[model samples]
Target: SIPDELQLQILELCDMTTLAAICRTNKEWYAKASPIIWSDIDFVELSGDGAYDDGLIDQQRQFFATCSTRMDERPDFWAALAARVQSLKLTRMPGIAISYKSKAELNDSNDYIFIEIWPRDRRNIYDVIAEFKNLHTLYLFVKDWWEFSSIGESEKAVAHNLEKLTNLKVGGQINQDMMLALLSRPENIQHLSLINLIHSPGQDNGPNPVLFLRSIQKRFTNLKTLHMSKLAELTEDTNITGARWEFDPAAEIDLLEEWADFLRHVSATL
Candidate 1:
């Protein structure tokens, strides 16, 4: 048998798949390999049959069910699972409506994934973020801007624990008020990546996205790295939301300038 230290070193060198396989062999292996595997949670888009069910993402429902079960039945393990997660990212959204079965309780759902898409089943990820207590990084990879607004509950829960977060990445259309709220929450955000942001221009009668872009300096004063993108003029309907709006080139330039000024500030701080 390999010594535990050497086993750990070997596991660290292996890729996630290999370590995950090793973790399943036994508790000894799990104790050795699970930590490294859980260190950085990266989720890519999953497809195939279970990607959609009856025009809904049924898989997400199962994930919520599982979390509910764990929270209720396996509190100790659930807590341990939460504490182990340091980095979290969900890279793709199922291109359909999220079907909520309020009639069915979270712990009582019967649609066990039988298995497609690794843990797209884990989309019920709110409590993991809210109660985790030690998350260092979070990435919400929303394909559509609208989806960001839908996860308000998760966002609010995360807000309570933002003091410990050091890195964050969010892509999608987020509400301007919440954007301001979250950006200010992190006390020492080291890296920030913002992608495909959207704003409701007509509602305010003034440019939107730029409003949040300009506020970054005040909200994230201690940021060390920042990336902002996707403000080109929208000439056609969006594939994700099927909504189109006027994109202001001039506003884009101003946001870019704000980002630059913040970068300069970051450089000065260094």
Candidate 2:
């Protein structure tokens, strides 16, 4: 009883799962809607059992693998899902290892509830990062910082590819090198929310890069909001007069002059 044009429109909005349900209505509908429905998939909540499933994730990877061959684009299937996915909330990792799936329960008030965490294999994230090019906002509920230390050690960090990202909220001591690696990329990141930034001393003889104690404010021109705690070092001065400012005097440095110059630079620019 459906018109051809209207039927096609409906098919465009449905996924493989819903298409299967629609197709059961009639044979003619099945023939017309099958291709569009099969094009992309949503697999975040695959199990009705309400627990993490390693086998299910593997099955999804395999399904995408086969779908990629047919589509002639290795990332087409994942890309489609990524584009559709607005937000993903990663909980603890699956069993037999550290879980990334959230211990928190979902509420109807929250728009973000479910996200896929890294597999038990620490290295699997390299591929995960490569897959989600359209991901703009990421929430990481990580238990271990080491789970992500190697992320940027390669050619570049995942931030390079996620050009659309505007906000990032994370927990843990994200390494300074990794942060710098991301900031170096020419992208306009507006907001960075972090907690527990446990900074270790850097090899640089001067001020450490992580502390933001030096003249590196120029690096984060687009940064607007910063949520953190206990960041300032005692070496940094609160004196607005700029006269009491001191650097390492053993190296024969004029602290006041250098502070004045930096102050002038900041004033002139803003």
Candidate 3:
């Protein structure tokens, strides 16, 4: 029989399915393969048609629930497992619309139909994030604007504690304050991608893309790649009949100078 160290090295080379199979075989293999399997937790929604998996959705829900339960029951074991997680991909399940109904409207049986299914628990997503001590790469696909803001509001300190975080990819509606709060503390962020970032023009002039670029330029010295797309602004116009707000594309000429400056600043790292 091979040495345990050699077995672990061999297990590391196996694919997820193969490792999972190995875990089911015996207790020793389970102990060896489990940590490697949990190292990268991917619940990211796959692109294109028929990519959504119902089983995966159920698993994600169960994961959150289990974390809440296990942390209370076996705090030491859960802490160790959480620490093993290095990469995490969090996204909403396709086709399952998140209902934002009040808690009174949701019964226990139908709570799963809504995104607020875990409200009863004290631990929100940010709490779960704080547990992953070794997290380096995080991919978060935020479906709602409030959810994006909530991250900044709830766990302002958690982002700062994520010293190992370097690669971050976020999508959905992001405002100026929320964006700044999210990016302010993650000093080691090297690769950043923001997709479908909706900029709402408020009293503070909304999401100033150029300003954000400048902030990024100042904050991250190790920054290499910065990718942003669908940078549109939402403006409220009382003049428009029946519609209060209108979507407008951000002016390219306005950001050209700042973009150039940012490019020059990060050119060495890039």
- RMSD versus native structure for model 1: 7.3
lDDT of 2 at 5: 89
Q: Which is better, 1 or 3, measured by lDDT? A: 3
Q: What is the TM-score of each candidate against the true structure?
A: 0.67, 0.42, 0.68
- Report the C-alpha lDDT of model 2 over 64-118, residue by residue, as the tens digit: 3343343345456555644553333333222112223333422223222122334
How do these models rank on lDDT, best leading?
A: 3, 1, 2
lDDT tens readout by residue for model 1, 58-163: 4444444555677778999888876777866554443212324422433433343222223233334454556656777777643332223254555577677655
139-249 per-residue lDDT for model 3 (tens digits):
765433222323443356554556688888876544555456557654587898877554432333343332466766766678878886645444553543333222223
Top-scoring candidate (lDDT): 3
Off by more than 4 A, model 3: 2-6, 15-18, 44-50, 93-114, 117-122, 145-153, 174-178, 185-187, 199-213, 231-246, 250-261
Top TM-score prediction, candidate number: 3
Clashes of each: 1, 12, 0
Query: What is the Cα-based lDDT of residue 205 in candidate 2?
Result: 31
**Hey, what RMSD does candidate 3 come out at?**
6.3
Model 3: residue 54 alpha-carbon error in angstroms: 3.9
Q: Which stretch of 10 consecutive residues in model 3 shows the poorest summed lDDT?
A: 93-102
lDDT of each: 0.56, 0.43, 0.60
